[model samples]
Target: MSHGVNNVRSRWTLPDYKPTQKYENAYRVTARFLLWVEKTKNRKVVDKLDAALRDGTYQPEMWVKLTGLTVDQLWKEYGDDPALALTYK
Candidate 1:
């Protein structure tokens, strides 16, 4: 039984997989936004974000309302933080 061979699931699980820069940037941005949300917002707002995501209703305006920051401001504040290094495969 070649369980090891069958166990392979997806390209992302491959050892040599490298995410594109766009994907990595998006991940970093989302992570930064979520961190901000956790730090500044209440649990109810987090719940709303979760629900909106689940329901396919999440929108940029929700972020603006919660963080009181526009997309440009978010990018300026968190997007270019060199500490948030991109992961390499």
Candidate 2:
């Protein structure tokens, strides 16, 4: 077999038991939101949001409105806590 085809299996292999993909999507979404916040507004909001995130009380909808994204989009993009997401509606 050619090396390219043979190595495909190796490339597809994930860590033996580690959930490396866990939170990756959330990180990506949060990173995007943070960058947007930093670019469009002062650091104060970012700092406040960061604090709220830690508190697990920040409704992602606020960011959704600021970013013009939909609740479903945020849901899929961030996988935010369902209870918090409910407040968005």
**Considering every candidate listed, which one attains the maximal TM-score?**
1
Task: Kindly report which residue stretches of model 1 are placed more than 4 angstroms away from their true locations once superposed.
Answer: 1-29, 40-46, 79-89
List the global CA lDDT of all models: 0.49, 0.44
Cα-based lDDT at residue 37, candidate 1:
42
Candidate 2 residue-wise lDDT, 1-89, digit = tens: 12123335455311221223332446444444444344444346667667789999888675554555644554344334222111110
How does candidate 2 score on lDDT?
A: 0.44
Q: Whole-model lDDT, candidate 1?
A: 0.49
lDDT of 1 by residue, 1-89 (tens): 12123234532321211222222355444544554445544335667778999999999788677667755565455435423222323
Candidate 2: give the clashing pairs.
none
The clash count of every prediction, one per candidate, is 0, 0
- Per-prediction TM-score, please? 0.42, 0.31
